[model samples]
Target: MSGRVMPGHTSDLLTLQDAGALWAGLTADSAVPTASTILISSLGSAQMSYALLGSHVVMAVKAHDGRWSISESEVRRAAVGLRAVKVDPQDLVRIGPFGGMPKGEHSEAVLLGWRRRIVGELQRPDPPEQVVPDGDDRALHLAGIDWRRILTEQSRDRTRQTWWLPRAVVRLLDAAEHVERRWLQAGQKESKAAEGIRPRSPRSQTHTTENLQVTKPDHLAASLRPYNEELKGLLYSVLSRKPDTSRKVTGWICTLCRKVPATVLDHCHEHGYVRAPLCQSCNAQERPDHLYPNDIRVTDRYTRLLTTHATEWLRHWHRCPGCRTRTTLPLSHLAAWTAYVACRPLRPTHRDNHSSRGRKPCGTLRVAWTGSHHTPHTCQLTVTIDLCPSGEHRDLAKVPYRQATEQFRIWLAKTAPTVAAAAGPDRLDDLPAQFRPVIPDKSDKGLGLF
Candidate 1:
């Protein structure tokens, strides 16, 4: 007895493993799903219903667009005085996120029947939630579990960038350090009983260290290391102090940002000479000699070097070829480089473009830097033009953002306004009191303000 099989894609097909028919899906149609179905409008719209089958009764429990859940009180009330109540052991369950927000949504709609004898018996909590992992903390969570090891491994492979958002035991580290500082101030006055109780990082031993130490990977040559004598000597030799140059003769990182903990070596595209260490944010913003594919202003040797750099840069951000102003994105992000070369102007799509889904949906090819210069935040689609046809019309290619936005944005902002504001305020409005329209000015001119 397969119930409504996941609504709109309803079919008679049901695999034995996938069939959990405890709680069937509810559809939005006005008529009730079945005579047994009960409506719970207080929860939301009558999009779902509960069924009171013989031996037990299960009610609708979903709360939002996401999953079905009820308050703890509600669940307790439903449990009542019945004994041995639950979804079937064979029933496939899992509606809510496990371990997050105590309420779990079943993978399928499941109805728990309440029989009228002792009232009801409590259902066993989902089985897997009870299992504890071997040698893991009781409070281990998705946001922090294995992140330290993961970050350390990532830093090893990608030596150029090592910055990661740290989210583990930050407050603990601070409190531990404060206790140690107080112990140091106490000096000999402290009792021997308090000797070894000073809290330290789990990874640290005799000498205290940071919870997660940011260290240089082993493969990096000593010359590229921030504090190396070789790097220091080189900086002292060629470093000139200009108004823009913030680095002093004594400091190690005098590059793009004096702070921000630079981890990679910055080198010149033309000479291939190492300049200084720069932070990850500064490293990516380094403009290569060649701005675009066939840029003529840059030297051939430098352009060739930069072209190689762009290929291995990892990110697929590109500038508009036509206007050479704002950046552009490919219609198909998977093949961004190929799409940019083929499409002169990436076509723009409004929100309503499901009909064109045989092709990738695209909006303004150009995204501009809004609050910060490092990353672009705004995708301005006001000037984009849809030059190509859709999949039904024979799949069309993307266009360059320069062609889409430049002329159109300018016309809408500057040129198009000329038609509306061509003639200034009327001459009568500009006139003084004595030069204002007299009562006998003209028969067509009305005298009253009304």
Candidate 2:
């Protein structure tokens, strides 16, 4: 009676509420219900096992493994199938996220609740900085205070300049946008409130309107002055350039991107420091080459912008080394060529290992080449080359892959200058010897000779 609680013979106890209550009473003495005490009910070939574990009743349906496993909501369904009343198990259940958090509940509050509120404040026109009315303001105030407190914890680290510069840069950018919106909204509210105030006299109505029209919240600007200063200091420290001149230009946005407020001066790396203001997004595109946090550079910020233009060119046409015809090339070849032009190393591939949760398994890179066809009727030959971090391929320095790739890409670009450039000739007589066929003919049918 104390260990496993099997349902007794009773015609009226078919409902889930009756079954749950009976199981609870029977297992009152037992902390955990065992398989021996669990009553199995069959719905066709599948069997449902109900166990009252301490205060909550847990149920498991027979899986293909011939074992019962517990899930969050399936037990309720199992109880219903056995003709029991619907018993909600949510109160007695403890639900959690996938990975365990080491910093405990406070970390969860910051990460889940506090971060979400900040994100919502940034994305929407919600007036977060304004004082809330009585009961309505309590939750918002608490959330705002918690978020600010978490950020303040990071401020001590922000005082020093080091490898954390990129993180600080990102945080500053986010804070700048949030504070700018809040300041603007506060100013707008002040202007609206000023308009609501009764004029001193009918004769002074025009004067009141004029004053209200120009009622810019200098006080709000004064209060948010630190955010503006912090943004400038962080930009100057991390990017090694002055704060974007746009900050001086009222209501400035990126001339090129048109999406975000222009925050950084986009210095043309190829054009000897010629600069223009651009949004962070456009700047990212201009310098698509991602550097490790510590490897941030001033010049590489503009490489990807050029690379994008080159890629758009490659998408339309590439001259075939074999036939000397302008044709669409594979995307992989185009990407490889772009990487070569940008002097970017190939990105490595990752394979997930579920067996070991903590360790990251080794990765591999595969390079595939499609061989030239002698005739269109014959199948084109493809060779797949696998490169791994082992033995001779361990360092990747032994192969000179980067150098060879650069040389080959340069040769192709020059040979297909018609595709890569607007001014280059369509036909080149000085192609590399290996690229030239054994014999060349004017006829299209016999383009290549053995």
Q: Pick the candidate with the highest TM-score.
A: 2
Give the 10-residue window scoring lowest on summed lDDT in candidate 1.
Answer: 113-122
Model 1 / residue 411 / CA error / Å: 19
lDDT string for model 2 (118-188, tens) is 33333344467966564332222221121222222112224531111122222223333433343334435
**How do the predictions measure up, each by TM-score?**
0.20, 0.27
What lDDT does the true structure give each of the candidates? 0.25, 0.30
Candidate 2 structure, TM-score to reference: 0.27
Give candidate 1 regions above 4 Å deviation: 1-251, 280-450
Q: What is the lDDT of residue 31 in candidate 1?
A: 18
Root-mean-square deviation per candidate: 28.4, 25.3
Q: Candidate 1, overall lDDT?
A: 0.25
Model 1 lDDT tens row, 90-186: 2111111112122222211122110100011112253766765653321211111121221221122244322222211211111222222222223
Which ranges in model 2 have alpha carbons more than 4 Å from their true place?
A: 1-252, 255-257, 273-275, 284-393, 397-450
